[model samples]
Target: MTETFHEFVVQRSPALSRTAYLLTGDHQLAEDLVQTALARTYRHWRRIRDGDPEAYVRRVMYHQQVSWWRRRRLAERLEAEPTERAGGDHTDTTALRLTLTAALRHLTPRQRAVIVLRYYEDRTEAQVADLLGCSLGTVKRHAHDALRRLRAVAPDLLDATAERSTR
Candidate 1:
């Protein structure tokens, strides 16, 4: 059973890491979040394996993100940097990606989580709510708020800019 759990986790780690990165836009933090979630999942693998273990782990990640955001005094630092760029070439599309991620950081942690799960992971609102342990209404509200915020930050203006930059 333990070996099965280990294999599952190893197979799923990349997917979870990508989801976490989309949620937080911080690679190191995403790695940490996924690791923490995986640790908790490992502890309860026997119980959760029969259920949707991925959803269980995702819930742990969401809760962990919310708790970390609250404890880190994020609300007070609305203008703080998202996270340092992980060293790369200076392209215009890179600039847009940074802008997009910066806009995403302004959302509440839960809203960010919702967007990541919904858009990035292609999950429905009910699924997101289930994973986050929230009411469906709350997930809808968060997703709406996140979309509104993203629109306010960049809107559709940057898509053209990004496409031009890529060429």
Candidate 2:
């Protein structure tokens, strides 16, 4: 059973790592977060192996993210700014993706987690709340707040780029 669980975790690590990356913007942090979550999941493999083990792992990741956030609020900005691209050459979609990712960086970690779970992972509010060990109301609030922040940061980039014709 332990071997099977280990195999399952190894198989799912890449996809989970990608999801973690989308949640956290840093590659190394995402890797560490996923690894930590996997280790925690392994600790409870006997009880959780029957049901959705991946769900259990994800729940660990969500709680760990929230705990990390509580220890260090996301209000502080990073010292290193993202490098600006030469605007004349980059495609609008690429630019929009970068803009959206950057805007996400401004969100509180809980808000960012809600946005990632609700949008990127396509999980419902109830699922997010369950994973985060919070109420549905909290999940809704976080998602609403995150969306509002994102909209405020890049209104034109998010709303008006369908027919962007940059020359």
Candidate 3:
């Protein structure tokens, strides 16, 4: 049986949101990514319903994000220190996530996408290349550059990972 577009969204939105968050690193951008992907997918719903619709949506998201990155050359931001939340549970995991998010911000959009796809999504290099519509060499280069930037920005986080791996 084929799934309706609305049903597919209800079932897949959470997973899509998580991936979008990892790809964009900001909640608003993640929501926009999901929204944009779904809009694009809906345009060909009948044709894609019986096929791999989720994959199609994801590909749209990746393309949209990369396009956003290209347009970002015209955007500017004013940085401000994040206000601390009072009386919240602050844990090592929370700290690590914050540091990782910060480190991810240092990478280019393609590099960030490569890191999220390769590590967070647990995709193989070839699969990531296919999804990003880039060559294997491009994926490898992005992954390499992303990791080097991460290590430079968050050495403690990388060292902690290494320590855990060796244990």
Model 3 Cα shift for residue 97 (angstroms): 1.0
Per-residue lDDT for 1-167 in model 3, tens only?
23588899999999999988877777888898999999989989999988899989988988888899898842422233323568965886676676677777777779988998899889999999999999999999999989988888788888766766887
TM-score of 1: 0.80
Mind giving the per-residue lDDT tens digits that candidate 2 earns over 93-124?
A: 66776776678788888998899899889998
Best by TM-score: 3
- Give each model a TM-score: 0.80, 0.82, 0.88
Q: Which residue pairs does candidate 2 place in steric collision?
A: none
With candidate 3 superimposed using the best TM-score fit, by how many Å does residue 45's alpha carbon deviate from the native?
1.4
Instruction: Report the candidate with higher lDDT, 1 versus 2.
Output: 1
Residues 12-37 of candidate 1: C-alpha lDDT, one tens digit per residue: 88999988876777788889889999
The lDDT leader among the candidates is 3
Cα distance off (Å), candidate 1, residue 3: 1.5
> How many clashes (backbone N, Cα, C below 3 Å) per candidate?
0, 0, 0
